[model samples]
Target: KKLSRFGVRSKDYYLYLFFKRAHKSFTLLFGCLLPLFFNAICSVITFGLLFLEKQFRLLDILFQIIIGQ
Candidate 1:
C-alpha cells in the first residue's frame, strides 16, 4: 500500500494504533467538555449582566432612554 512506500512498516503499526486510540479519547473528552465549557461561560456572562443591571439600574436607564424621559 501507499503506507509501505512511505516506509511505515508493520513494526511501527502499533504506534499508529496507539495514536488512533488516544485521538478517539481526546475527541470524546473534548466533545463532552465543550458544551459544559460554553454553558459555564454563558452563565458567568448572564450573572455578570444581572449584577450590573442590579447595581447600576441598567434596565431603568434603557427604559428612560427609550421613552425619552
Candidate 2:
C-alpha cells in the first residue's frame, strides 16, 4: 500500500519482486562458487610451476628433489 506513494504501479511492481528474488539467489550462488574459483586458480599456478620445473636439467631436478627431502 505504501508503495503507491512513490508512484510504483501494480504492473511494474512485479519487476521489483523479481529483482528481490534474483538478488538473494545471486548472492548465494556467488558464495558457493567463490571457493571453487580460488581452487582452480591455485591448481593452475601449481601445474605451471611443475611444467617449468620439468624443463630444467635432470640433474637439477634430482638436486631439487633431494634437497626437498
Candidate 3:
C-alpha cells in the first residue's frame, strides 16, 4: 500500500478500513488514492459553487436582479 506511510487511523485509512470491515466488494489497492480522490472531488464541487455564484452575478446584471444584498 502506497499509503502505508500515512497514519492508519486517519481519513484515508479509516474510510478504506470501514469498507473492509463491512466486507465491501470494491477496494483500491492504493489507499493513498482516497485522499487524492477526496481533494479532486472537493475541488470540483468548490469550483462549481464559485461558478454558480459568478453566473448569478451575471444574471443579476442582465435581469436587474439583486442577490445577497
Candidate 4:
C-alpha cells in the first residue's frame, strides 16, 4: 500500500478528509438550524391548537391584542 508524506496510507488520508468535510457540513446544517426548526414546528402546532380549541380563546385574545379590539 502506498503511503503519503504524512505516513498515513493514501486511502486513509482521503477518507479522513472526506469525514472532516462531512462533519463540518453536518454541524452547520443541523447544529445551527435544528433548534430553530424545532421551535418553528412547536410554534405552528401551538398556534393551530389555540386556533382550533375554542374553549381556550387564546387565538381570539391574540387577535384582539393585535387589532386592539
Top lDDT model: 1
Q: In every candidate, how many clashes are there?
A: 0, 0, 0, 0
Residue 40 in model 4: lDDT: 99
10-49: candidate 1 lDDT, tens digit per residue:
6567788889999999999999999999999999999998
Q: Which stretches of candidate 1 lie over 4 Å from their true place?
A: 1-8, 58-69
TM-score per candidate, in order?
0.67, 0.55, 0.50, 0.55
Assess the local accuracy of residue 6 in candidate 4 as a C-alpha lDDT between 0 and 100.
55
Report lDDT (CA) for all predictions. Answer: 0.89, 0.84, 0.77, 0.86
Cα misplacement distance, residue 24 of candidate 1 (Å) = 0.7
Candidate 3's residue-wise lDDT over 1-69, tens digit each? 656656655877789788787664334434667889899999999999999999988988877754444
Number of the top-ranking candidate, with TM-score as the measure: 1
Q: Which 10-residue window of candidate 3 scores lowest in summed lDDT?
A: 22-31
Arranged by TM-score with the best first, the candidates are: 1, 4, 2, 3
Candidate 2 TM-score over all chains jointly:
0.55
- Candidate 2 CA-lDDT value: 0.84
Model 2, 1-69: lDDT tens per residue? 686755666556788889988998999999899989999999999999888877666768788899995
lDDT for model 3 comes to 0.77
